[model samples]
Target: MPTKTLRIPTTDGPADAFAAFPDDGKRHPGVLMYSDAFGRRPVLERMATELAGHGYYVLLPNLYHRHGPAPVTELPEYIGEEVRPAVLARLMPVLEAHTADRVLSDADAYLGFLTAQPEVCAGPVAVTGYCIGTLYALNTAAARPDAVAAVAGFHPGFVVTDAPDSPHRLIPGLAAEVHLGIAEGDVTPEIIGELTRALDAVGLGHTCEVYPGTVHGFTMADTDAFSAAGLKIHWDRLLSLLDRALARD
Candidate 1:
């Protein structure tokens, strides 16, 4: 895989990002991968490369570029349960500051930049997210239904909310096939049913299921909540969703 550090021009400023793609010199499908609340890091880069190796152009951007580059706040190498609370204490303000308007702005810039890359083939792309990025991914897919063919999220957070503009409410606008691999207890059965109903109302192909024996952030290897088995299930569902949605005639 060939990876390059790049900057995406957003309404706020230039957001630091990176792209991973095959070295075969042929254009490939594009995937916009949103990092978890921890933001971009080695693990995310590795994930992007792994997805790239499967024959797609993967772009990972720093969600907190407005505050500064990735790791906007210093992070411990291993986020054990004891250290996670402290980390969240420091990050909550930053995460909360990223309002819906900012998300929409960044989504436009990110999608525009991804599709414009020479190595990315023309047509709709896929968006995948982890943790809090799930909200972002859903927002992006809803905002750009025509530009996105697939949307997948792992251990998602804040996607189903009571707010009038909650992500679930936006499902009617989405054209992408959707799959959500939830960590056990990360979401309530009631909310999951609500999300399913919204997706069904829109008549789109979708699934929202909780991964057995996993907790929030189960797909992140650097987190104490990481579950190897859960991660495997995530990749399986994610790849298949992408394959079915992005397949060309």
Candidate 2:
């Protein structure tokens, strides 16, 4: 796979992003990968490269580009449980600033850049996200129903909140096949039933599961909550969704 640093022109400005694609000259399906609140980092880049090797052009953009390029706020080389709260403190404000309006605006710009690429095939693409990043993926799928074919969210949050604008509300308009890997501690029988009922009501295609024994950040390698099994499960579910939704000749 070949990886490169690039810029996605947004309504805000040129947002710095990373891209990974197969070395072969042929174009492939496009996958937009959104990072956790940690924003872009080596872990995200490696994840993008691994996915690109599987025959898709994966693009990882800075979700907090409004403040600045990724690492929007400096982060520790390793984020352990002891420092997790402080990190979330610094990031929450920036993440909070990304209102739904801003997310939808940025999605249009990012999707335009992705679909316009010579290395990307002509068709609906996929969007994969982790942690709070899942909200971005959901918004993109809803706002650009024509351009997004699948959505994979790992340890997702805020999808079924009481807020009128919760991400689940966006499901009715989405054409994407959805997969949501919910962290164990984040859900109860009630939450699961609520979320599932919403999906069923819309007649949307989806797979929703609570990853057993995994905490909120189970898929993040640098966190104490990281679970090897959960990470592998995410990869399995995510790739399957992409393979089926973005299948091509």
Candidate 3:
């Protein structure tokens, strides 16, 4: 596999990004992978490479690009119990700074960069995200339904919120098949039912399920909350979803 450090021109500035593809030298389907609030790091790069090995061009962009390039601030090797609070404190503000308008603008820039790549196969692609990135992935797919064939999120919350612009509100706009790996206890039964009803109401193709025995951020390798079982489930669901949604001509 080959990984390249690149920049994506956004309204705010040039957002740093990375692209991973097979070394076999053939164009493949494109996947825009949104990083969690933790931002980009070596672990994310490895994830991108793994996805590329499955015959797709994967692009990981810095969600906090407006602040600066990835690792906008130096991230620790592991966000252990002692440093976890401090890491959240540093990241929360950056998370709050991203307005809905900014998210929409950035999504356009990311999609533009992915679809335009020479290594990416032409036509509708796929999108996947983690943590709060779930919102970004949903917004991106809803915004360009014809361009995104599948959308997946892992341990993503805030899908069903009191906010008028909640992610579930955008379900009707999405043309892609959607999958969400929910954390245990993240959402109440009523909320899950409500979201499921919403997706069903729109006749959208979607699967939203809670993974048993998984806590929030379970798929993240660098966090103490990481669960090997949950991470494996994510891989199985994501790859299967991608295979079904992005089948070649």
Candidate 4:
């Protein structure tokens, strides 16, 4: 595998990002991976590399580039119990600043750059995210129906928020296949019902399920909530969706 630190040109500014792709001289499907509120870091880089190894050109951009580059805030090497509060404190404002409008604007730029990359296959791409990144991932797929082929999210926050611009509301615009793995206990039955109804209204290919016994942030190995079984479930679902979507293109 090959990795590079790159700058992605966005409407807001030049976003500093990290990318990984197989070293083999062959173009692969592009995957735009959005990081959680924690921003781009080692855990995300490792995840991107793993995805690239599975035959995709993975790009992980700093969603908070409006604030600064990667490491937008000084995060502890690991988000342990003691440092969790401080990490959230620094992350909350950035999360708040990423309004729906901002997310849509950045999504346009991200998909544009991703599809244009020399290493990427010239076709529809996949988008996946964690936590708040999930909101952006869904919105990105909805906003660019022609470019995004699939959208998958894990442990997403604000999917059921009171806000009118919540990701669930935009489900109708999604032209891509959708897969959501909700954290066990994070989403109530009422919220799940609303989400499923929204997806049904769209009449798109989709699957929404709660991973058994997995708490929020289950895919992050550095988090206390990490669940190996749940993470494997996520990988299986996501890769299958990607294969179907990318194969169509």
- Each model's lDDT: 0.92, 0.88, 0.89, 0.88
lDDT of 1 by residue, 1-249 (tens): 899999999989999998999999899899999999989999899999999999999999999999998889989988899899899899999999999899999999999999999988889999999988999999999999989999999998888888999889999999999999998898899999999999999899999989999999998999988899998999899889988888532
- For all candidates, the clash counts are 0, 0, 0, 0
Put the candidates in TM-score order, highest first.
1, 3, 2, 4
lDDT (C-alpha) at residue 68 in model 3: 84
Against the true structure, candidate 1 reaches a TM-score of 0.98
lDDT of 1: 0.92
Q: lDDT tens digits, residues 51-160, model 2?
A: 99899999999888889877888788889988988998998899889899998898898899998999998999999999888989998998889999999988887778
lDDT of 3: 0.89
Return the lDDT, model 2, position 14: 86
Output candidate 3 Cα RMSD.
1.1
In model 3, state the lDDT of residue 174: 90
lDDT of 4 by residue, 193-219 (tens): 988899888788888899999999999
Q: Which ten residues in a row have the lowest lDDT in candidate 1?
A: 240-249
Estimate the TM-score of every prediction: 0.98, 0.97, 0.97, 0.96
Steric clash count of candidate 3: 0
Q: After best superposition, candidate 1 residue 220: deviation in angstroms?
A: 0.3
The residue ranges of model 1 lying beyond 4 angstroms of the native Cα positions read none
